[model samples]
Structure formats: C-alpha cells, structure tokens
Target: MSITVYPARRILTMNPSQPEATHIAVDGDRVLAVGEVDTMPRGDGCVWDERFADKVIMPGFVEGHSHALEGAMWDYLYLGYFPRHDADGKQWSGLKSVEQVQERLREHAACLPAGEPLIAWGFDPVYFEGTRLTRRELDEAVCDRPLVVMHASFHVMTVNTPMLERAGILDGPRVEGIMCDEQGIPSGELQEMAAMFVVFDALGHNLFEKVSSPHVLRRYGAIAAAAGVTTITDLYNPMSDEAIDAMVEVTRSVDYPVRLVPAMGVLQWSAEEGIARLQAALPRSHERLHFGLAKLMTDGSIQGYTARLKWPGYHDGHANGLWNAAPEVLTELVQAYHQAGLQLHIHTNGDEAVELMLDAIDQALTLWPRADHRHTLQHCQVIDHAQLRRAARLGVCLNMFANHLYYWGDIHYQRTLGPSRCQRLEPLASARRLSIPVAIHSDAPVTPLGPLFTAWCAVNRRTASGRQLGEHEAVSVGEALEMITLGAAWTLGLDDKIGSLDVGKYADMAVLDQDPLQVAPAELRDIKVHATVLGGRVHGGD
Candidate 1:
C-alpha cells in the first residue's frame, strides 16, 4: 500500500507519548507514524500531502452529545435568539422578538407547498423575559395549515390551532408536558417528548424519522466537516431498520466526512426489545458507522422549566419540573442495559435527575459488577460536587452542556437555578478535581455544533449578556480542548481508535489556521478551521 505523509506547520497530536509533531505518515486510513518528516516511516511509494503545510492540526474533534436532527432541522426555518450558520455555511440571522418570530413563520409558511405543515425550530422563550409563544400567536402566523415551532431546547414545542385539532391534543389525555390555559384550554405549548409525539403523529412526520434519510445524514456530515469535527454522535436515534441501512450506505462512502455514532434510543422500546435490537445491530458496526451505544432519557430541559430538580426548585417558586422517565423506569432500564453489557448515555439535566441516575447506576454496577462501563450522563447542567463524587465512584462519565453557559447562563442565574446553583452549572473544574472522566458538548441544534465555541464557553464561562457565570468552575484552555477531543472520545468509548494521532489509530485530524494553545482564551472561538482530515481524506480545505 502507498503511504501518505501530511506535513503541517505544527501538530497537536493529543497523544502524550509524542505530544507534538511536524508531520504525520498515514498507511491507508490509519496512522503509521507521527513525527518530524525525517523521523517518520519511509517507504518507496511514499507520497507527501502538503495541503495542510501552513496549518496546525489536532485530533479531529469528537462531539459526544448531539443529534442528527441538527441536519433535518435546517430544512425548516430557524428561529433562534443567536445567529447560526446552516450546513452550507449560510448564516441565518437571529430573530429578536416574538413579533419577528411570527413574521418569519408567516413568510416561511407562505412559501411551503399547499397543505404541508410549517415547521420551525430553535425558538427559546427565556430570552423574551417571560413571553411564551402560544398557539394563538402561531394561528396568526399560519392558521390554514398545521404549524409547529420547536423550542431551542427541543424539549418543548408550540403549535397552531390547526395542529392542536389535527393532533387531537385539545382533548388528549392530561399529561405533565401538555400546557393548558387558565380555563383549561389547550395552549398549544407541548413540553417534552410524549406531548410532542402527539403533534408529530398528527402531522404524519416524525423528526427522528426525517433525520434518518441519506440526504439529511450527508448534510449532517457536511455540518461536522465545516466545524472540523471528524467524529460526532447522533446521541439519540430511533434506530429503525431503514435508518440503520441508510446510515450504513451513507457512511460507507469515501466522501462521507465524519464517523457517525447513532446511539439507540431506549425510550423507543422495552428494555428487552432495545437490548435485542442493539445486540443484532452490533455486528453491522463499521469504521465509520458505529452502533451499540444506548441512550436513555430521564428528564426534560431546565430552561423549559421541565427538568426535575431537587429541593428549592426553580428560584422564582415555579413548581418542580417533569420527568421523561419515572425514577422506577430509569432504574429498570439502567439495570437491564447494564446487565446486557451495553454502554449508555443517559440524559439528566437537573440535580434531582442526576441524583436519581447516580443511584440507578450504583445499583446496576453493584448487581452486574462490570468493569469500564463508561456509562455517561448527558447534559449534566445542574449537578453538584456531591453528585460529582458519586459519579466518580460509579465510574460514570459526564458530557456537560457547556454551551448552556453562553446561551442560558443569565436566565439560569436570574430565574431557573438562582445564583448559587447557576454558578455550579456544568462545573468542569469541579469534575476534574474529583477525577471524574468528563466531556463538554454543544447539544447542537440546541446551541450550535462547534467544539471550539463549546471549549470557549468552558474556558471563559461567559453568558450572552456578558456575565461571568462561574470563574471558580472555569477550566483552562488546555483542559477545555481535551474535553472537546479525547475527553469526548473517551465518553463515547472511541478513545483507543480515533482520539489522537497515535500509531495504529485512525488518521483523523482538524486543520486550523491557528493553534488553539497559542491564542488568547477569548479569541479561541475566532480561530478559523481551514479543513478536517477524516481517516486520511482531506475535506473542506481551500
């Protein structure tokens, strides 16, 4: 086989054995050696790839917690508070007020095919200072068709009267997530999955199902490639046979930009059913399409006031939040999945949820006694040091929603969590002190899918309103970088294969215009990604 040597101005290998390198030699899709060109393995048919000669290269970033829905959501109108870039690198300006949001919806609705539903996403009510989007407002946007607006959290959604009537939500069974007005009229604000599923069923479209398409998956890859991400997880997948087949077909292609890890959503099946499905799918796993990772949902979003929190819940004296899965259900799933020997990524956004999951993990480990389980807690935004200690003892990794600091830190400080708890949100430094294996994430489509920006959030701990959230909980730039790369890979159990430029590992790398270590902490996110090299294939370079 022919060898290819990629010469770079500098390479941050992330492999401590040889921490830095000026060149990397690749044999096929795996790293042969990484060092100075003279020290690299020499071969008769060696080829020098100098595309990244003036750039700095690091291990391709691994996003431990994100969804393929990110790609699918772009097909709809974006209504986020912060300006965002789509897959094709087009910037969609942020909508500032409810009037602007409704106006955009009206405009987008007019352009949609007749009788088709109008779907919009990334709408956050917290930024509006207590102004909630109602079905009445949505009706004004597009009363004739079924219109739905998904919140930035994806934990809540608001629909027009047409959608509510079509979904039969007005007369639907009373549930924790179904919001009703004072006179018991359905408000069109559906909180969490169960309530949202009603609208999805009525609309004859499932967002998760929509994300399984080859086109959407490819778009997802493009988004990752643009962000210099080589490995990213679609953290919760329904895992239909068609979805699996589509992913296999897409990732098998040489042009596919990133390794896709789609965790089977346990919520979609009984414990036995999920286990059987995952066991059957495990054999289909490949170099680019990974399977066997399981995802469990325990609670809702804190920003939506739907996350289950412990005592002194919601600083403004709002009632306690909702649970996606009851405590008993969580315990049952944890025990079953753990016994089945599958790694789990459980979503626990609040402190109470964190405590419950920790207990469940403790029980499962005691019963099964498996070593190196690496079951991770996703979106662990409100965990305390005590919970961190328990997580450390249980060997549970944390994939923190660090981007929350930038997006909702001010709101959390003022309303949801109060000052004391908000200060402790996504405490990476605290997790490091306790030696708990940890990673930080964008939870993209909730925030955006840029690891550098996520790292910047952890390093700077700055809110959108310019508030310093938690200086004591802030981690250094080096530590934050690890959280996005190897640390994230470790959480996903892909560390050995692709986290760094170690010999025998996949030759995956992100080429940058500047070294993150050399930049100011505040300017870290500003550093441009020139390209990404996935398994030795260069993508998105000039």
Candidate 2:
C-alpha cells in the first residue's frame, strides 16, 4: 500500500518519546512514522497529504464511559435544563419550569395516536425549586394513555396515574424503589431499576432492545464523529445475540465513523450465565466492534437522591439512598467475574457505594490473584481521599463523572452533599496524586457527549451557577487533556492500540482548528473539531 504523509501545523503525539511532531506517515490503517517529513521513511509511492496543514492533530478522543442510548434518546422528547443538540445536529431548547414540562408533554401527547404511550427523558427536578413533577401533573397532560418521564440521571422516573395503575404498582407489594405519598398511596415516582423495570414491562418498551437497532447504532456513530471521538463505549449493554449482530452489521460499514466498545450489562443475568454469554460473544469481536468487557451497577445517581452515601446522608434530611444490587449480590458478582478473568466496569456513584465496591474488589483479588485487572469504578462522583488510596492499592481505575461539576455542581453543593462533601465531588487531582489510573466522561444523555467540554469541566471545576465547587480538586489543562485521551484509553484497556499518535498504532486522530494546549482553559470547550480521522480515513472536515 502507498504511504500517505499528512503534514499539519502541529501534532500533539501523546507518545513520550517524540511528544511533538510536524508530520505523520500513515500506511493503510496504521501509523508508519511520526516525525518531520524528512526523518520519516520515504518510498516510491509516498504521497504528501496537506489537507490538515493549518490544523492541529492529536490522538482521537476515547470516551471511556457513555451509552448508545444517547442516540436513541433523541427519538424521544427532550426536557432537560440545558439546551442540547441531537445526533442530526438539531438544537432543542430546555424547559425551565414544571408548568413548561407539562405543557410540552401535552403538546407531544396531542400528536401521538390514541392509547399510545408517551415517553420523555432528561427531566430533572433539581432545576425547578420548590416544585416536583407528580403523577397528577402528568395525568393532566395525558390521562388516557401511559406517560413516563425519565430523569436526567436515568436513575429515577415518574409516571402518570394511568400508567402506574396499568403497571399494578398501586396494588403491588411494597418495593424499596417505589415512593409513596403521605396517604400511603403509590406516588408514581419510581426510584431505581427494580421499580423502573415494572413500568418498563408494562409499557412493553424494552429500551435495551431498541438500542440495538441499526438506526440507533448509526446515529451513535454520527454523534461520536461530530464530537471528534474515534472510539466510544456503549458502557453497559445487554449482549443479546440480536444486539451483537446489529452492532457488527452497522460498524462493518465503512461509512460508520467511530469504533465501538460495548461492555455486557451483567446484572440482567446470573453471574454464571453472564460469564458464559460474554465468553460466547468474544469470538464475534470485530475491528470496529469490540467485546470482552462487563458492567455492574451497584448504586444509583447522587443528583436523583438515589445513590447510597456514607454516614450523614442527604443534606436536607431526606432518606438514605438505594442500591441496585444488594451488598452480598454485588460481592458475589465481583468474585465471579474476577475469577473469570474479565475486566469489570462497575458503577458506584456514592461514597458508601465506592467503599463497598473497593471492598468487593479487594476480596475478589484476594480470592483470585490476577495482575492488571483494571477493574474500574464509573461515575465515582462522591469518592473521598481514603477511597482513592484503596482504589490505587487495588489496581483499580477511576472514571470520574467530571461533567457532574458543570451540570449538577450547585445542586450537589447546596442540597445533596452540602458544602464540605460537594467540594470534592469528582476529586480528579487527588486520584492522579495517588498514581491511580483516572479518566473523565460525559455520560451522555445524562449530561452530553463532548470530551473537550468534559475536560474543561475537570480543568475548571466550575458549575452552571458559575461557582467553583472544588478549586483544589481541579487539574491542569495538560492533565485534563490526558485524562480524556490516554488516561481514558487506559481505563478501557486500549492504551496500546489507539490512545496516542505513535508509530505502530492505528492512525486515529482528531483534527482541530486550534491547539488545545495553546488555548485558555475556558476556551478549551470552544475549540472546533475540524475533522476526525479513523484508521487513516477522514470523516468530517471543512
């Protein structure tokens, strides 16, 4: 194959041997050399491609934690606090009040066919002060059909009275996740997966099944490409044969711009079944679609008041949070997966949950001695210094929800965790100081999918209200950039193949209009993504 020498204004190769370069030579899908044009090997068919001569090139971003639902979510009504753009590049305005939310629901309800269920997502009650969305309010929008609104956290959801009645929640046995009104009636609010599963069954809309469709997969690739990401994780997926087939079919197409790394959602099945399923699916792994990672959900979301915290719980004296998996169950799953030699990506949002996971990992490691396990804690928003030390000692990675500082920092500081606890929400700097492998994520559809924006949140710990939640926990721009790129790659166990622009690695890079390292910390998110080169094939550019 002919060698293509792509010259650029500058290349920020994360490789330490030659950190900066002016040109990179690509042979097929792999990088042949990264240096000045003269120093690179030349052949008879070598061609100099100066398409990005004025652009800065860096390793394409690796989104360590995100979901394919980000694409499927655009199909539903968006009721988030912040305005967002969909996969098709259409911008949707944010709803400011409960009244506005109801109004939008009413509008959407009128357009739908009679008796058809209405499902909306990204509804956050925190943004609305002194008010909450109740079933009665949702009934006023569409009393005849089922209406369910998913919270921004995706941890809790509210349903209309008709839907609650349809799901038999009102007459069902008392469940921990089902909230009750003052009169001991089902309040229409479902807290965690258990309660939500009942509603999902009644609605007959299995979201995981829908996410595997080719259309959703294509949209996910488009969204990732638009953000200059070359590799993204569908973090938690039900690895059904049909889902796997859809992923393979969609990703095998050359037009699909991003590579996918899907981790099996192990909680849906028994530990033995999950291990068996993962083992069976390993043989089907493709270049664009990777398998062999597993996910476990221990607790819920902090913003939704469903995450299990340590000692003094919620600031306003609300009840303690709930766990998706009981402590014993989580420990059993951890031990089984560890013994099976699978890298686990466990979700633990609260301090208590973090502690539980650390203990479980420790026990699992003690039972089965494995090296470089790289078991990671995702959305570890409320972990403290002591937990960081334990995580480092256990060889565990921490993928902090850095985007939380921007989206829900004020709420965390003022209501959920109070001032002192909220100050160290993500604590990226502390994790780095302990020499723990660390990464930051957007957790899309919860926040939004943009690593540059996520990096900026880590660099400047500033919330939507312009408050610096934790100045001490903030990391430098260089550190933040590394967290999004190489650090994230490390968490996913793909550091050797794609994190940096090094020789012998895949030629996957993000072409930028401005240098991220040269810009002001505040300007990092504003930097334009000119194009993304995946395996040497450019996707989008001017």
Candidate 3:
C-alpha cells in the first residue's frame, strides 16, 4: 500500500473531534491519519511531503450551488460588471455602462464573420441608472448578424432585429415576457423562460439551459483548483445521454481535479424518467459523481424581475414573476422523487417561492415519511425568521446565495424590496439562530465562484455601495468558514464522505497563504489560495 504524509503550518480540519493538526497521512486517496509531524504514529515506507509546510491548510471548500458552465462560459465573450479572470489566468475588465458594453461588443463583433451569431453573457441593466440595453442599442453594434446577449442573471435576453426575425417572435403572439413598444413592435427584450426560449431556439446554443458540454467541466475544474474547492455542484444539469456519458468519463478518471455532484434537472425529464435515468446511472456512480440529488428551479431571479416575491411586489411594481411549476405539480414532483429516495434541491430566490417549496417538501415528506431528506432550498435568498424556523422543522436545508448582498444588494435596497425588507435579505443569522443547517454559496456565473468571497460577504454584509445590507444577519468568520466547508457538504448530502478532514474520509485540503480566521474579515477575499489537495493528490502547487 502507498502512503504519503503532508506537513503544513496549521491544519483547520473542520473535524470537531481533532479540529487542529500539523500533519496529514494519506493512504492512497483516503486519509489514514491527521496529527503533528513529530508525533505522527506511522509505520513503514511512508513518504513525507512538506511542500505545503509554509502554508496553512484547511478542509477543501465544498461549494453547494454552482454550475460547471462558469468554466465553459469563458470561451464566450464576458461582459460582467465585475472583473473576472478565466481559467487561462486572462483577466477581463468589468463593464460599467451600456456605452462600454456596446464598445466591447462592437470590438468583438468586428472579428466574427457575418451571421455567425455574436453571443455574449454577463450583461445586466440593473446596475445602470437611466436606460437599459435594448434591441436598438444592440443593433448599433452588429446589425446584420444575429446578436443575442444573456443577462448576468440568465433570466433576461436582449436580441437584435436579426434574432427576432430568425425566431419569428417579432409578430408572434403576445408572450408574457416579451416587451412591445407604442408602435406595437416587439422591443427585443425577452424575460424569463417563455420569451427567452424564442431566442434560444433561434440561436441553437444551450448556454442557459442544459449546458453539459465537456469543456464546461474542464474549465469548472480549473476554476475550482484555483479557488481551492474540492467538490462542486453543477446544480441544474439537463442530464442528456451525451452529458452523462461525458460526466461519467471525466469523473471516473483518476486525475480529475475536483469532484462533481450534478443534480439532474427535473424539467429535462418526466418524474419517472428523471428517477429512472439517475437510477440507471446509479450502478456506475463513483466517489467523484454522487448522483444522490436532483434540481427543481422554483422561480427566476429578483434583479431580473422574475423572482416570485410577495406583498408590494417589485418597487417598480413590475410583475410577481414566473413559477416553473404550480404548487400542486411541484408537490407531486417532490413526492415522487422523495419516495424514490433522491434528495431534491429546489431553486427558490423569493420568499413566496420558498413558501411554495416548504409546502411541496412538507407534502412530500408527510406522504413518504423519509428521514434525513437534506432537501436543500438553493439560493433561499429572501428568507425570514419564521421561514427559517419552518425550514428547520421540515428538515430542509438552506443553501443561501449570500453573494447577493454584493451582487444585487444596492439595487435591491434601492429598488426591488426597498430598505426595510432588503436589509433582511438572506437571513443567515436567523437560520443559525433557529439551529438550521445553512451553507453559503456564490451560485457562480451568477456571482463569481470564490468561497472566501462568499464567506466575506456573509461576515461583513456590505454591499458595493458600502452599505451594511443586514447587520443583524452578519455571521462570524469561523461560522462563515463552516458554511463553506462542512455546512456546504451537509447541504449536498456528502457530509459523511467529504466535508471535514477525518480518518477514512477523502484527504482533501486547501492550502492558503494566510489563515482565514486570523485575518480581518474584509481581507478574506484578498487572501490567496496557493493550491488544492484532492484525495491526497496535489493539484495547482508550485
């Protein structure tokens, strides 16, 4: 048997029994023991690796609500408001105004052949004051070719005239999300699924829906390695045969950098088919791809005006938002999946959506009576004290999009929920106060994929405008770290296998330049991740 020992400056195991350590012993991919170097009780032919001796080691981050597409999207044009670095270490500057967005699109469109379909993502009009990007503005950049831009939230799409002409939605029926002007012309602004599908069908790219291309997993892995994440979720995959085959191959490979837990999208298949499809893949399941969970997108994004919020709706009084499934149908779906023994992680950004989710899961559990359901409500953003208590009672975990405070906090404070409700937006403290198991996430590509940044946002609760979004909701740095580690693992239902560093668990570690607990909360996002150790195999080390 092969054995290796890694010595670090300090090890934050996240294991309550032996929380701190200086050395970790690995037997193949699993941890054999963790303790100090001089006193490590080891026998025979064990290799001692001290490369990380100068760096602090913590349990590898467990990101519960990110998509693999964050990696794949880099191949396309990036127009995100926040500066992002691709897997290749190429940094793209953030776009502030529509003028800069148009300039960037024009420059990128100049190189592409005509009619090639200039596709760009990470565009949001929420940050701007006066006017948002419309089809008219997009036409100025590339008139002849079909230009389709996906909003940063993925809930809205802005397409040029060519796109509308190709899709035949220009004169088509008055869809719910399609905007028409005084002249009765379609405004080229499509919101939510009903309208976005028109553009999706024309473009023929599954950028938003069912993106499981192999390149996605590669880039996602690269990003994970850089951020010191060991296991990540492709939270809402469509589970096509091609995608599953690719996932199986890549995950089964011994050198796969990060582990993946892809929840099959319920919308992609019938309830029976969804269960059977995953059941079919169950025999082939490995340590890397744990197919224990499935995803159900309850509603849309708040900033995109698609989230289903209650009472006084949007500050602008737009609309209530779209429900992917009715309460009864959602209840039936959850019941079927829960009865079949698959964990369901529903996407609910709004409190009303959360209410529907609470009802659905409650009905399912009441009917099936299964314990340890760990059915998570992903991006449970606008939750309240009562909802947190109800969630705890129902045994439903909350994987909050804590990054919302930074990504859309200012806008939400000023526009959507206004100050009173906005200040209470992701009640992390309320969840903890109620003794509910809560894990924080980036929901990457929605926000970026850095857990430290997610934790920083949780600890600081500061928005881009430097306003304290919810001082009452702020958590301590240690608690925030737990949210990213074991708490996240529990939300994913992989707590027993991964999460904390322990004997018999996989030896995954994130080597950091500085200790997160010792550093100021503001500097948490600034602290660099030197390398990641997955299953005792070192990746991204100098």
Q: What Cα-based lDDT does every candidate model obtain?
A: 0.90, 0.90, 0.86
Model 2 misplacement above 4 A = none
lDDT (Cα) of model 2 = 0.90
Q: What is the overall TM-score of model 1 with all chains considered together?
A: 0.98
lDDT digits (tens) for residues 1-542 of candidate 2: 89999999999998888889999999999999999868877779898888999999999999999999988998899988899887777898999988889898989989999988899999999878777788988988779899899999988999999999889988877677898889989878999888898988988887656768999989888889889899999988888888889988999998889889999998899999999999988888776888989999999988888889998999878778898978999999999999999999999998999999999999999989998999999998989898989999999999999999989999988888899998788999999999999999999868889999999999989999899987999999989888888999999889989889998888999999999989999999999999999998999996
**Which 10 consecutive residues of model 2 have the lowest summed lDDT?**
203-212
Q: RMSDs, each prediction?
A: 1.2, 1.1, 1.5
lDDT of 3 by residue, 424-527 (tens): 88899888988889999998888889999999999999998899988989999989999999999998888888888899999888999999989988999998
16: Cα error in model 1, Å: 1.5
What does candidate 1's lDDT look like per residue over 1-542, in tens digits? 79999899999998888889999999989999899978876768899888889999999999999899888998888999889888777999999999999898888878888978888899999889868889988887789899888899989999999999898878766666889999999998998988899888888899878767999999889988889899999988889999999999999999999999999989899998889999999999899988989999999899888999999889988888888877899899999999999999999999899999999999998889988999999988989888988899889999999999989999999999889988798999999999888899988778889999999999999999899987999999989888988999999898999888999999899999999999999999999999998988889888
Clashing pairs for model 3 are none
TM-score to native of every candidate shown: 0.98, 0.98, 0.97
lDDT (Cα, 0-100) at 392 in candidate 1: 90
